[model samples]
Target chain A: MGQEMSKIEEAKNLTQNQILEELEEQLRVEEIEEQPDTIKTEEMVINFGPQHPSAHGVFRALFHVNGEIVTKIEPMIGYLHRCFEKIAENRTYAQFVPFTDRMDYVSSMHNNWAYVLTVEKLAGIQVPERAEYIRVIVGELQRIASHLLFLSTAGLEAGAVTPLQYYFDERERILNLFEKVCGARLTYNYMKIGGVRADLPDGWLEETLSFVNRLKKTIVDYDRLLLGNYIFKKRMKGAGKISAETALAQGLTGPPLRSTGVAYDVRKSDPYSVYPRMDFEMVVRFQGDNYDRVVIRSEEIKQSLRIIEQAIEQIPDGPILAPGLPKDIRPPVGEAFGHIESSRGDLGYFIVSDGSLKPYRLKIQGPSFANLQGFPAMAEGSYFADVVLTLGTLDPVFGEVDR
Target chain B: MLTSGQLLEFANTNGIPIWVLDASIALLLSLAVFAICGLGVIVLVYMERKVAADFQLRWGPMHVGWRGTLQLIADAIKLISKEDIFPKNADPWIFRLAPTVMFLAAFVGLMVIPIGPKLVVQDLNIGLIYALAIPSIGVAGIIMAGFGSYNKYAMLGSMRSAAQMVSYEVPRALSIIGVVMIAGSAKLSAIVNAQSVWYVFLQPIGFVVFLVASLAEINRVPFDLPETESELVNGYHTEYSGMRFMFFLFAEYIAMMAASALTVVLFLGGWHGPGPAYLAPLWFLIKVFAVIYVMMWVRWTLPRFRIDQVMDLGWKVLLPLALLNILITGIIMLL
Candidate 1:
């Protein structure tokens, strides 16, 4: 039994990159021996994106293909860059909240919360209990909305059109809820430095509770519609596999890291907002392949619903915004970092204050940027179709990736 | 009721020259086939959109002529009016010829189908083999489009289509063999006449194998790797435009009709429903549309399989099942 345990441990310790290297070496030696000069094949380098469908946005990659198999991948980014950080330097701390919304525009609420959390930490502002609870509720709702987009796009990349339409119905409802709360759907600048922009409107809590309850039932239908499908599972099962160490080393967070069984969520490891008070399991899967990465997001949506339900029940009646704050408030000369578990991954904002109204230097550590680093590694030596599937599973929003 | 032989005899009675009569009859038959297939393509396109919309939870093409009935006509006009573009480095002759070859290949397959009693263009003795063999010619057109386009995505799409079509032809042919053995003829009309009980009942496994392999053969979803929109953009026809692009679209829907019609003849007892002889074509069309509807339903509901997985299913699973189906049919015949 001890010998078997050690053997299992050794197998688990084998890095994915090492295995890929060994396989490539074997393939290389075989190809060198078998090839004849008369029938030699040349590798074709094809540009996969920048204007392609299923790119999610204006993301580009060069794929070197031998027949249908991809031998190498080179990712090109920054086409959607809008000089967000540079613009942040010119604006006041309060004025910068709206700028963060455009970073990861799909889940703008989470971006809003992450930026505000950094500012709150830097300015030493205290948020009321009710505001934290409201933040948690909206943040969890944004997570669900973001994940719904991911699932729909993933379905589309796999060539299933019905799931995209079906999942969008649910995402539209979530967006409607956001539109009601913040008066803007796509870029909700609802979070302030110390609290939320406003309290729940009449019957808002009941409506949110109803939405979660309805989603909990429909998500099962979604699982049956897309996730439980035979062809979908076959497409995803062993494709684009990465090991736990490789995932962590690539700085992957959220579902991508959790898929490798790392169990490292920013909300759980370092508690934020009302997350510590909420009872929910950190969703994890062990395969770390495209399938697990997708499945983990569905599981996380369930957990997010759990968190929202708990927050709504525990919310206290208090102030929405902090009292006695200056209109153009300045922070002391110091640096502060705040991270949140956004829909895609760990979204963090780092601020360097110089006792001025505007930030001296502001940096956004976007999870999409970091998660995309692992894509080429996973995509190498995969089939051309699997490369697209792997990119869909990674779910990098280009707004964040090129921010 | 007007067979080609009756028309030729009528021309002979009128003292018309045989050669001129033959030429005119050939022209007339070609025009009739073209007209029927053209009308069929428009209806199939509209039906495909409506069916896809129904599955996708939206109103599809509602503004066009009463729930998108005239949408395809509008599309046809648009396609006809568009500029025909040839890429700078494209091989003009091959690029120009590809869509025609593809359209003709699919078009000719419909000539052999027995829509009603004595209604076929030419009920040749080798009709079954001809229908199967002719559509494979479309692969050549696909390869030509890919090679002549000077585009990498088109090249990849064409290569994938060639590989997929070639691989699927085996199981498709094998699956049909069980029905051919029981029917005792390769002529499509004879085969349909042999089905007192539909072949789908006795050859259930063969029916399934034929359905799946034919789906792959026609390049429907779940097996649509050649023109995977997300992965390959527009695939082989990426650079095709104007009437040339319309040819590819027309060929696809016609090919879909041909496949579904062939499925009806082989399995569902074509033109054999309880009805008058005048209504036989209607019954045949109803069966054809039913099968086409199922194909569209599957297309919307399922995601595509990766190329390797598709090849695996074709070779490892369906091939063996098809062979076993033949084996079982032969054993029962011996008993």
Candidate 2:
């Protein structure tokens, strides 16, 4: 046992690719061994989605179960794929901002910001001070919206209906605030290559401040209703536990990784936009269980509210769009990658420009796609009900995952 | 005042043949009971929707009839007019018969409940036990539905339903034994007559255990693992549709009513409210609906418990509490 522990510790120092190769080798060797002639009953294999209520989207998985205990899970994704990265290569840099909005539709502001930030880095365009503050405000507002959606759906998945409606009421207010700035509510194509689409509308700042103030009180009520619920805590506390080593090995980021005490948020670590100026702590919990994942998101919403409040107070007056930007953005031959702490995790965009109107190659590192890798590890050997809870806590939007 | 026995005697005095009168009276009695239960289901369905809407901050059933009073009737019409679909591989007979069996289980229990003085459909010598025993038959119906559907979700749901219902029955029955012991009879009417002090005050533990166990038996929220929508889609009724689906819905509401009625009879001093003797049935109904309102309140507020957590709660918490209540009741009776 001591030798096995030392071997595992040594293996942690290896790269992810090397670990995958070793895992494949181990599987090959195990497959060649003879099976013992032991009497066993047939395990039921259930296809749990593509059209399930609690599946979050068209995500599907084959769950192999012994009665109610899930022994193995094979996650099948790409149902909502629309060749997003392929389309990005054909469209010009400025034309692709709208496409980013469709990636993580719930947090479109963050998606737009991440994409534009990458293009800004590639083009060497400088964003004005005021535009940076607006970007920060909208990004944090989008985080609150996305995390509220996570809490609502997580509650719905757990069989509590009231929280969904209550939380949606608050989310509707946030969406209205978004609509006031941009013309759209869901897929806000508001973030430009160097700045935002427009400045804050008349009284928009006051409306946002009022909404943020109201949410502070409402979040306390939500904590009493959902986070403090005995049944919810009992169901989620120790279920779907993922160790910190397993999380880091799986390349998990954002709240799912932070819940395991990693504290590696892109906003905190990379310090993009005005995040370094704002005063807020990265929400982290030491338990990598479903309960911690949920609680961390709830706490993150509070922190997002704090960031939004500070950004609103500190926002300066300036041009919303970058000055002297050409209609067709043709950057010099280069590649650049920019990441943000999206509500799900580390949302990054890598753009390769070849001194043309269109990008040579564009890749999206969607957090949901990476975060989904940790699910089977957490779900195996748990009760069948906990599988749904684990999936809810992971909060993978199929649009982002399959993109 | 208008017992079926009195009506039979009046028919005999008029020189009617006994066999003809008996058949006619039995048919009429069954029809009356069915109408009451059917109407109760409609009201309960509307009430559940309105209550849920109220909790969720929405106006429920407003467009159908005066604040959605006729919404269920419209829904019933739509269900009856729809195409009846069955899974191709499903067992045809059991698939068709499951809903009927489920509905009849609750219907039979309803017949034995003493709504008023001389108001029961058939107050048997063992009315209390009959009401408790008959509803357990619904577990068989749930199993049949799951087995016949040929779908894994329905199969899992039915297995959960069977386990939850069976495990809860022990606590449910044991909890009520305190009432039976204190009343010195299993007949529901006699039990009601004996509740001068309202057994809830005397046997509070038993009342609470019975309430929790009955919620599990009826598959209400927090114990609604059998048809947990998030986990099992529609659970045992995944393959049922059209009028067949409506039957399962009817059975659920009917079972809820039966459980509430049983709660009223056992603990809440059935028909003993301050009113005219002729208004006893009204008092009984008031208490029954009150219990049902509380059940719906709980359903919307609480999230569901997992299968194992539900089992733990039933066997570990509620069962022991029920036994202790019975033991305490026996000791008091001896003193």
Candidate 3:
């Protein structure tokens, strides 16, 4: 019985090795078979996305994976091809604000303002002083909200869900204010061609004051939860270090550009909408890394809060919307590109009016779309984990990228 | 001879009723602590949410109880009612046993915690040591769940957690040595009593080391490598579901509570009186919450570390520093 058991054990060992050898041979044969097809093709082709989770959206990065490295990334878009620009061409200026919501849904207000600001410039309409101030406040608040969402989701991709919940909770408060102001929460069509849709509510000032005051403690909490964390530092620091030269070449702006040590904020550089009087500094970071991106967001939130506080203090007692304008808005035949510092980057809207109520053409220069262009360039030699971190720091809004 | 028989008969009759009553009370109080653990787990989760919300510049649970106080109630309801699922290929007993093992570990750790003066469930002389030993048992549960799942990611996560816990254990234990040497006792009450000025000011280095190590051991933030979403997904508990999943979650929060309580006992002076005896536990809880808040901040602010870096920091930096802290404490004590 003992001799038979020993023989059976030996046979089992032999069978295990045989199975291992067979599996190895199968893998080698599969590799051998798969390589020739790609090698024979003079044009080496690889599809990087569409189905890939890290493409930021339905955007595809068709590329050649040389070993573990990405050789090239060809961005294949139109998966979310609603042709928002074309849709805007047929709609009146007032009607187009809703469509603007589709472009960068994270910061829909920025898009709305950009479109309206362009039309307001073409029509040569002067917005009320209080309305302009309120617009700045709302726009700045939305920018903070959008950036916080970016921070949260980016952190989520890095396996940090607590911060995501924290940020969304804060974002919900801003959304509540939006709902109170415009009667719409996520997609607020508050901005009209000439001015805002409605006047500020009765307790709007008091509510805004309380929100501003409470903002600091929450910021401290976020700091405790994330900023001061060692792991967060390890993951973020030196992870995606882009230089100012590369960023400039890529036409990067807003947080990404600022992260590369540039101090160019649209509010400071161009001073559109009553930003000239606003007391806010351009938040900049020097490392040009993921850490810098996070710091830039943090600093920007502070500046945004500052702007909101100032707006509340200086808001003149006047009509919320500019009066004495034609109900059916029309601007003369002209074209203008209005740019705003959206949460992701610089959001631009080029409007071509044909002296009609509707535009002849509307071209949206989505910052997230442009910002996503450089992802493959950055992701070449990095690990898969870094790819997630890098993509997070870029803060891509699929709505903007796809639109 | 008649008098001796009468005395023996009288003593036996009285002793039985007193012993029975004491036994019943002890059992009832143990039951109460067990009940409190259930409530404590729910509150800890809600508190984390509220704290996180406050940090992000928002109100957390306004829709639930007064300011969303009842949010945990809703969450508990959701978790309890959810379907408990086990994979077809999983080891049936281990899969069922893993969460229970984790829960049991947490519950045992709570036995050593002295919430207030004489309010302990068990005032064992080895209470502090018992608290320290219980968390390591959860590692086994993690490994069991990982192995039983038949998922590569879960297995990898389990391996990662084992390494992380082992590495973190050194600094965590060594940091405690400073307080241990100063108190001259392993008893938690003695440790708290020794800290009249609070160990925070005296052994600030030890405090910092303990905080970092505890955070790592609890698997928060930069140390949360085992379950990194971009890497290992949901870590060791990937296949867990329903009440089992909740059990794992409860264990994590309980671990958090345990770590916080340890911090209070060692550095912040646990249940020491700034107020009346009844209010002292509240103060202890507040200190623990503060530590938890700091943990949250560290999580949000910092990025995660690679496994190698985590181990290197633990073995090379924290271990040596913690040892030095203990040595210096010893020298100071001798003088």
Question: Best candidate, lDDT-wise?
Answer: 2
- Tell me how candidate 3 scores on lDDT: 0.79
lDDT of each: 0.92, 0.92, 0.79
Please give the range of 10 consecutive residues that has the lowest summed lDDT in model 1 chain A.
A34-43
- Tens digits of per-residue lDDT, candidate 3, A146-174, equal 87887777677666666877788788889
Clashing pairs in 2: B61-B68
TM-score: the better of candidates 1 and 3: 1
- Prediction RMSDs, each to the true structure: 13.0, 12.3, 9.6
Q: Pick the candidate with the highest DockQ.
A: 1
Location of the lowest summed lDDT over 10 successive residues in candidate 3 chain A: A63-72
Candidate 3 lDDT, tens digit per residue, B94-136? Answer: 8888888877786678777777777677777877778878887
Per-residue accuracy of model 1 over B73-141 as CA lDDT, tens digit each? 898899999999989999999999999999999998888999987788899998999989998898898
Kindly provide the TM-score of model 1 when superposed on the true structure, using C-alpha atoms. Answer: 0.94
Output per-candidate TM-scores for chain A, rounded to 2 decimals. Answer: 0.90, 0.90, 0.85
| Residue B143 in model 1: lDDT | 94
User: How much is the lDDT of residue B264 in candidate 1?
Assistant: 98
